[model samples]
Target chain A: MNGDLTVSAASKDTLPTVFGYIGIGVAFGIVGKAAGLSPLLVTLMSIITYAGSAQFVIVSMLVTHSPIFSIIFSVFLVNSRMILMSTTLASYFKRESMVKNILVGTLLTDESFALGMNKLNYSDNHLNFAWFNTANVISYMTWILSSLVGAVLGNFISNPEKFGLDFALVAMFIGLLYLQLISDKSINFNLQLIVVGFVLVAIYFGLIFIPSSLLILLVTLVACSFGVVMKHAFF
Target chain B: MPSFNFVLLTIVGTGVVTWLSRITPFVLLKKFQLSKGVVEFLSFVPIAIMSALWFENLFVQHIGHLPSIDWANLLASLPTVLSAVISKNLLVIVVVGVISLGVTRLMMGM
Candidate 1:
């Protein structure tokens, strides 16, 4: 770990995330356009919403003419995970000013949050505000711009599937999941990974009955609690 | 065309909900002290959440049924997962996965 990698240099580390965002953003744009949304409208939605999955859900609901209340409810349900993520990230930004933290928190997406946390974990510095903000800002910009491009060219590429853009976000998530694993020599780390995997798979199976958002929230709480209990009892 | 008011409401409503979710914890947790046990356990949240997301996307189709395996995605993910294990680089993983899926789609003539 080079201690000399300044915050600016660390910001460049988000370039890969930038690519992932653009891919997913374009997919969203294409879908939005196909759903009869104007390019300007979708771009505005991206700017304000800034959430990929939620935007996708919103667009699909719009197409179906679902009630606005349900659209709002579904987006909230999908994005409720942000609450957990924000809480985790809050502990890290304890020293920063409230305004800056709020600004940074608005741009939090799953990829950016995971990558930002990973960088912080591996780095020696206490908290590199510039690096974290740069990563978030770049990710947000890339997503908005790419989505606008996709909406504009929505007519050109009738099938985003032929290009396999749908898999980009999933691939990115897989990479992120791989990155989150700590390669330490601790047995507890491995045990935690196994527990998380087991819990997630169980939740997946449980989805047949439990609503996905509620199930995921329940699983997170239970899994985290189990981790606490296990650490206290054994580790 | 959908009514303009409905569209506007959709955007504004979604924005409000999204912002509220993101802001609540930042406001509530800032002045509070969290327990060590809780923080330690929260470390695993990312892995748990990401796994749920990746698997849900790869496997699940809809509500109230078993996730039928999509062979194209499954076959394509094989190389992608292998590359992910080998290289923690996001670019490498995405390129490998996209190309793998593209070739599979081509062969299957879908």
Candidate 2:
């Protein structure tokens, strides 16, 4: 009975994550259509890029007819943080099969990482790889299918922008940020200061720059370093 | 319009590079154990990157100008932040945020 309860609870926990992905996926698809990408291309992007910020950057760049080099460089800059996410997650996935690890890693977005990390803490199972893959695959499929739907129906939507679909990504990030910031009791002040400082710097540089991607990258790295140093020196 | 070959290559390149970034850390850490200090440092990277991205979007402008604090955006952002804090659900937060933005825009006659 205890084992069955645990199984049920585990399944229940995972269901919300899948449902959350579906909702975000639909929003992403609608945003993709508004951004003027074709349904097939958006579907491909949802499957291939999978990173929401990078996809937004890609679409924005495509709309502007930016050079190929700029597009690639911007994607690289925006995604550099994934290096950190992947590195931290490595400890949890060290023992998985190579093929499984690769497949799972490909789907390790911020949402999946948060969900998988929570499940990891509660369960002592060795099927970490499976759980991670399940979350990723479900999220990936949701994104692709919904993007296709949005693309096809995009024409009839008239002005989806009127719905403020663009802010969907921002809302998702802010929600995640709120959760993380609220949970950390000690360093909330420092985190806010760092965020504000970065925002100011991004604004300053943005005023002078044509493509703000590189400037944002520089300000972020500097702010991160400053925060780390401050945490060590004072806190 | 971008040629089909160009689109294909872009997709392939993005997939290949993204996969490489995801896999490298896992492979390296597994084959050779990472230090505790390194892991601890890495834990903060996501927040750092996320902050940078979020901050940039809120302030950066397309025409090499400062992002004007359009009242509609600010009003919409307020409710969005509130929903995010109270709901703790991604879907609810996004839905409320989008709706708020739309309603605020209409109210502002923008």
Judged by TM-score, which candidate is best? 1
Which sections of candidate 1 miss by over 4 Å? A1-7, A184-187, A213-215
- Tell me the tens digit of each residue's lDDT in model 2 across A149-210: 77777767745557666666566556556655654443556665565566556555664654
Clash list (residue pairs), candidate 2? none
RMSD of 1: 2.2
Proportion of native contacts in model 1?
A: 0.60
| lDDT by candidate, in order shown | 0.77, 0.63
Candidate with best DockQ: 1
User: Which numbered prediction scores highest in lDDT against the true structure?
Assistant: 1
* TM-score for chain B of all predictions: 0.87, 0.73
Model 2 agreement with the true structure over B1-110: per-residue lDDT tens digits: 46555665666666666677777887777688887556545545545555555555455364755565546656777887898778876567767877887798778776
Per-residue alpha-carbon lDDT of model 1 for B1-110, expressed as tens digits? 48767787789889989988887787777788888766786776777777777766655545788656677887888898899899877789888888888888988888
Q: Model 2, B49: alpha-carbon shift in Å? A: 2.9
